[model samples]
Target: MNTRGFYDELADRYDLMYADWDASTTRQGRALDALLTTSLGPGPHTVLDDACGIGTQAVGLARLGHRVTGTDLSPRAAARAAREAAARDLALPVAAADMRALPFADASFDAVVCADNALPHLLTAEDVRAALAETRRVLRPGGLLLLSTRPYTALRRIRPTSEAPHVHNGPDGRTITFQLWHWHPDGERYDVELFQLLPSGGTWTTHTSGATYWALPEEETARYLREAGFGEPVLHLPAATGFHQPVLGARRPVPHTRSTL
Candidate 1:
């Protein structure tokens, strides 16, 4: 499926669908707030919300006194984010860009945030690594990188054929329909697809377009972080915070000279 259109169609109603499903928008907002505060220190002025969807959390960060730049693959979603920023009388630079290759210069932001299982949208380990590399490149030395992914144990507990209705509210004040398709697990990776139904009653299906996730254990994710050139990552479990089941906080290493150089 073409995820671009799927998200574009749901851009206006993204919030409503999640509220109906009992998803925690407030908790997510707080998690993002805490992440920004912890990583960039108090009162950060600049931030990047990668895969920012409709700028929900981006707005929250801005409300907390940060200058936010939000990016997403869907143009409609980006526009929605821009409108939301305007409504709040905040300055948000919303752009449509790919996660694997962001349109920014090195050390461009004080911090980068990719929440809501955004990492899983990339289908392979290479994609994940590339996204991380890009994120690291855009962050200042000693900058913070905060991200969340599904726990492997949780993924293991679910069946491949399981179906769930994930809803979102569009800017037009209508509930958007989304159908989730879960596939059998393959090694550490699993496949999932999202389908959006038009409010007019017809189904407009977008294929996963190679959507996959590597359900990395906390240890594995930390190892990946270290390999990606970040400092040691601190793991936070859901018990610590009512947000993500497991959150990883890592810092980009401050540049150092090699003795042999």
Candidate 2:
């Protein structure tokens, strides 16, 4: 299935995949906030969480007092994000929209964030460029863009059969989340089956969803950003940034024109 349907099916269990979902929100929010403050010069600025899944970043940023908007391909995810924002008393505007073409007017946001390896969802260089171009279109001149992705350089070297499962125990008992990857021979694309196993009374219940993504290396990500009209993209590591994944910082430079002699 496509990403929208895959995520839609897992909306209820998505949060369960994380060890400490609420803590992750705060941590991720702070990391993005720091990048924004340094690259975009302190906000109170309008921000867009383009691939916001269940308000993880949106609501947290809103809590920090920035105006935020969120959008996801899945209607169910977007609705959950909005509801989660409200539950936290943060008013965030979220909708179901494709990342390739955002519904906002040109130059609308001061900054844009696509966290949690969102860009690779496109699965092709052309699609990735289209999404980046659209992101650039909605940003104000000199806008900051923050993105995070897995370090595929290492990932590609070890084409593992499966990822380590994230298992958590709660009042309901145990919930185990993991992914199985079927890599394409090209080495840059993988079909991912996300599985969530939950304790159902006496036995365990399993739910599976599948999707695909292109494995984006830092080099390719930077090249596409520049091709899409972005300025130099700076790479930030988790060691330096305290973020879950490696981050990239880029800017929409001011337009320049030749002067008449």
Candidate 3:
């Protein structure tokens, strides 16, 4: 499946990927809010979640009082995010959009968040650069940009075939989520088959989705951030940030103004 199809198929069940979806959202929100505050230092900044899949980060950030707007390639996912936000009495406007070409004005936001291993979905250096360029264009001068992805450095070495299954026991009994990876010969890209199995009477119901991703290491992503006109690109490991994945933080540089003689 393609990117949009993968997410669209998984929209309603996306939260099932988390053992405790609500708790995970809150925890992730807190961690990300702290990161944003530490970097920007203020209240209620305008933020854009460029790859907001079902509002995983956007909803949490919105709850923290940031004015957040979200966009996703999957219309169903974006719609689900809006519904999720509304259910919480939060105003999180979301649209279906591609990160490579955001549907917003220039300098439209104070911060842009591309979390949850989203950027790697581009699968090519040029595509990644285009997305970053769009991210930079939408941010105000010195606007913060944060992105998260798996630790590709280690994964590239190990090239694991599958991920450990995540088990969640809820009102509906038990559900298991896991992924099987098929790496390309290049070692830099892979196709993922995401599977979720749920209890159904005596049998189990299985749902699967697929997508391709480039194993974008922090060093490579940081280089793209710089080449896209962002400055001070820094990688924050999960050990330091308490986040699940490595977070890369950068800022759109303030354009230098020439003084008249």
- Tens digits of per-residue lDDT, candidate 1, 129-205, equal 88888989999998888777767656655644434565555544444444454554465665555454434434443
Clashes of 3: 0
- Give the Cα-based TM-score of candidate 3 against the true structure: 0.98
Tens-digit lDDT string for candidate 3 (59-94)? 899999999999999999999999999999999999
lDDT of every model, 2 decimals = 0.72, 0.90, 0.91
Model 2 worst lDDT run, 10 consecutive residues: 36-45
TM values, all candidates = 0.79, 0.97, 0.98
User: In model 1, where do residues sit more than 4 Å from their true spots?
Assistant: 20-27, 163-180, 185-214, 257-261
Task: Kindly indicate the candidate among 1 and 2 with the higher TM-score.
Answer: 2
TM-score of 1: 0.79
What would the per-residue lDDT of candidate 2 be over residues 201-244, giving only the tens digit for each residue?
Answer: 97999998899988888988999999999999999999999898
Error of 3 at 247 (Å): 0.5
What is the descending TM-score order?
A: 3, 2, 1
